[model samples]
Target: MLHGKVVLVTGAASGIGAAAARLFASYGARLALLDRDEEVAALAAELPDAVALPYDVADRDAVFAAVEQAAARFGRLDGAFNNAGIEGLGGGMAPTEGYPADEFERVLAVNVRGVFNCLAAELPRLPPGGAVVNTASVLGWLGGPGQAAYAASKHAVVGLTRSAALEQAARGVRVNAILPGAVATPMLLERGFRANPDFAEAAPGAHPMGRIARPEEVAEGAAWLLSDKASFVTGHTLAIDGGLSAR
Candidate 1:
């Protein structure tokens, strides 16, 4: 589906990002995998025709430089899946009244500012056919008690995705976001499940599907949004939440 395309995926070390990277590569996309972990290099090695570029998404200058370097190396950038983010300290579930200031700042730095930084760096370099997929959460449209900071960051991402899509649409560059529900990931396991030990086992009941979504399930949506298959789709917040967001 993505044959001969050049795509960039952030947070590519593990979880959804890693899953997306592998899926995109399977569809014949040459990948530029970005992440802060050294393991990113190993993950890159596991995929065919991929290069792992290790860097923190929150580092504005580094993000710009890395995008430039990747585009230069590949000759052009076709699409991007800006999926790097953090759930915040303890899943950021603390009530607003007592949420730690430092943790709030750190979460915004990676989740909001990171997306802003990537869009800034990528917009000018992307050609007319390019597309971008931002990883948002079901929380963007709903409320999570005790998760004010994290929820706010995701809401900002949704706003950014919409505005960026408008700015790029006329040029044929599409920007969209995927709002996922409970997925079996490290972040979810640690923070989400920690908040509710039965969350892993119980979350599925909340969804109509009777099971939590797999990372690959979400990746399928992202890959389509980034591909020509979704040529007319833009400024859209696609809910791949197993019906959890419906209620």
Candidate 2:
């Protein structure tokens, strides 16, 4: 569906970003995979005409350089998936007064500032008919105890997506965000949702589907958004939460 398109995807080393990169490449996109991990080079080797660049998305200068490199490699900037983010130190829900200041700042730096950095660097380079997809979360729409910082940062991403979409619409550069629910990823396992015997069952049970989403499933939505198939879609957050936000 993305044949002949040049695309850049952040956080392309593993999880959803990796899944999306593979799917886009399968659909014939010229890929530029960016991540902090050098392993992304190995991942890039498997795809046809793909380039992997190790980059810190939070660094504005580094992000600009990477975007320039991608435009140079691909000959144009057609689409981008700003999907790099981090869930700050996990903690139980508490009053706003009790939330850790440092944790909130850290999450914002990665989630909000990271998105801003990429958008600033890429927006001007995107030609007419280009598209950009940002990864939000179901938490952006719903409240969760103990995840205030992450939730707020995701909300910011949703806001950024909508505003950017409107601003870029007249240029034919569509922008959107995807709100994914609990996905079965290394991040989840690290957070004790899977590896921790105590929360494993409860985590899956929270979703209406009785399980977390697979990274590839979320990537399906992402791929669609980045393709011409969603030509008229923008300034919206497509939810892939298995009904988590329905309630």
Candidate 3:
């Protein structure tokens, strides 16, 4: 599917990003796994051909540098999964009026600016037929109570994805976004639910499938988008939400 391609995956230490890295590797892609977590190196070590890039996507200059480093190591960048993001301060579900200003800024820094940085750094380097997938969320489409910052940031990612797609379409570089529902990721199970226990039970029911998604399920959509199989697809938002968006 991705034979000989060099793909970059941000936030590759765990959850959906980690799953995407492993899946891309299995498809014969060389990987440039970037994460703030040092554990990303161990994940890279497990792969046949991968290099762990320790980076914080919020840093614009660092993101550009890391992208360059990946191209240098792999000879070219064929695809990228810009999946580095945060659920914000405690899933960012606090009442809007009481939501801390600093926390909101922090969420925008990592979620919004992170994707912006990646796109700016990556697009020029990707050749014709190369692809990029930005990780938005089901929250990007629908609003919920007490999730202002996260919802806002993800919505921004959707906007960015569409705009980038339009700009790059004629050049033959496909750009798309994936909107995923609740998934069993450490950020959600460990951090999000810890902050709002009620959601642990409620989240599954919110999806029409009546269950949270496995990280690999979401990764499958990403892998397809970044492959030649989705050659004609661009500027599209594919929902991997198990019918949450249908309702």
Candidate 4:
């Protein structure tokens, strides 16, 4: 489990991040919960020894400071869940010539650059045996009609994980990425997929498992990666996509 260890999780206010934070806490991790939402404070208060940090992951300095503070409080940095990301505005493939440049950039900033910022700050602080897990998406491997930007950002995250894992292997810091499929979370609800008449049939049908994933299910893979049980694992992207990518 994660007894006595300190784990920092970004996007800890909701969805998979929140689930992972709670799960880690249940396993006795001293949690540092980071999210842009001020509500993270209340959520953290429920845990035995958790600190909620409200900051924008897009801001490199702020992220660095947050990681430093977490390490200082816990006396060591053992693990981190770099799960902060944005879905971006869904856009159709309009001949590829008229894609919205700004929208694409914004998605990259949060999903790709955000991961980089956190890693840049956290890697130096992590002691030997430290582990880091990042959230990518099944779309990173597969393609989506109107999800080009989001998919590309996730693909970049996977690449970052592989490269960072190799670079940090000598230090005993394992880095891995999680590729989650259509998880039932607030983000999915906000996208209105659940309410759509066709969603019920089309969504689950996409995955070979015949169902969308729950956030907690994805968190399970994350927990394993961040634990000593996966000490030999690094630079790998574990797909928790209900066989979506396999199809």
Candidate 5:
């Protein structure tokens, strides 16, 4: 559905962001893949008509520069997937009272402030029909044990998505958020699982689908939201969680 449109995907080096980049490319979209990881450059090299923008989303000036550079490279930006985020300090599983204040600040800076920075830079450059999708989490809806910082940041992301959607709806720009369940990504496997030994075993059963999601599954929802197919959809929180939230 994207066909020749230019889309900016943050966290494009891996996980859902990487999956989205490949999927969007398959749909004939030109890509601007942004990530702090240099691996993004390698991914961009593998795609046709793609540019790698290596920058950290937490850096406001850098994000603005990257967005401007992407638009300049592609001539116009048709859509975006604001997907870059960190779980929290050391897998982020900590009691709220004990959750280090610095860690909480760090998470907010990256997850909430980072998305804000991207939106601030991207919205003005988008045309009437341009779309944006922010990556929230299923935790944004439900609380988790020892997940205050991560949950709080995702909740903020949901608020940002809805508010931005309302602000831009009249201009024909769509903004939405995706709340994903446990996905088989490094963020979960290497970090989260390591922090909570039982997580890997219990995660599948937590979902009615009886399995954790693949990054591509979450990316699929984002792809449609960013495409013309969902033109009327805005301020919506899409749960790509295999029925986890149904409980």
Candidate 6:
């Protein structure tokens, strides 16, 4: 329970972000939902005590503005789930040497730099006892076969979460990351299927549970991390995968 708290979630248009938004709201938290997609507005509209903000995570100014606006609207900022990211073009499944230079740069811009911008903007805005959870990936710890850029970006996110947690420890703001594996989000399904027709169908075999995680499953972990229940937790990388990394 996040009752009486004001929380912010980026990438709220869909997938894990949107699922987190819904779950947090159900816990009685006021929500500030941000995403570049216009659908964020619609998602926000469906929830009670929610405000949708349209902005790009890669845009530093836009990230700051959204944080400032959310805090202002809620009267205070308590926690955030920085989840906006891109898998990149070219199906995000190219061999390292064959990866497009521009796509690699774009992935870093959105996945790595996007988290950097959000942390920079949100840290100072958080009052004491605030918490933040970044959405990294199982690839953050394990190298992907044909996903060099994505793996690198997520690794950066993991490192950033730790460094930030240390910096804000004395300030009573906890920063952490969640590494999920093959969640059945559109991002995973669409691009993966594009790269290999069997991607969507075969993903379940990659997990020991015999199924990829659902967006809501990942959201549950995020909700717990962002709540006061995790007050003693910070600078930790939680693997929400269905035992994918155990192998």
Lowest lDDT sum, 10 consecutive residues, model 2, at 190-199
lDDT of 1: 0.92
- Per-residue C-alpha lDDT of model 2 across residues 1-247, encoded as one tens digit per residue: 9999999999999889999999999998999999988999999999987999899888889999999999998789899999998877652344567888987888898899999999999899998889999999998788767678888999999999999998999999999999999887777765636334656667777788888899999999999999999999999899998887887
Clashes of each: 1, 2, 0, 0, 0, 0
Models, CA RMSD each: 1.2, 1.8, 0.8, 1.9, 0.7, 1.0
TM-score for candidate 4, residues paired by index:
0.95
lDDT of each: 0.92, 0.88, 0.94, 0.88, 0.94, 0.92
lDDT of 6: 0.92
TM-score of each: 0.97, 0.94, 0.98, 0.95, 0.99, 0.97
Lowest summed lDDT window (length 10), candidate 5: 86-95
Worst 10 residues of 1 by lDDT: 192-201
Candidate achieving higher lDDT, 5 or 6:
5
Candidate 1 structure, TM-score to reference: 0.97
Candidate 5 lDDT, tens digit per residue, 7-88?
Answer: 9999999999999999999989999999999999999999999999999999999999999999889889999999999999
Q: For candidate 1, write residues 1-247 as lDDT tens digits.
A: 9999999999999889999999999999999999988799998898888988899999999999889888988999999999999998765367798889999999999999999999999989889999999999998898877788889999999999999999999999999999999888888876778876755678889888888889999999999999999999999999999999887
Model 1 spans > 4 angstroms off: none
lDDT string, candidate 4, 165-185, tens digits: 999999999999999988888
lDDT of candidate 3 at residue 102, scale 0 to 100: 93
Could you give candidate 3's per-residue lDDT for residues 155-242 as a string of tens digits?
9999999999999999999999999999899999888888888888699998999999999999999999999999999999999998
Q: What is the Å distance of residue 17 in model 1 from its true position?
A: 0.2
Regions of model 2 farther than 4 Å from truth? 90-95, 192-199
Clash pairs, candidate 4, are none
Off by over 4 Å in 4: 90-96, 192-200
lDDT of 6 by residue, 1-247 (tens): 9998999999999899999999999999999999999999998999999999999999999999999999999899999999998887646478899989999999999999999999999999998899999999998999988889999999999999999999999999999999999887788776676777767677899899999889999999999999888999999999988898889
Comparing candidate 1 with candidate 6, which one achieves the higher lDDT?
6
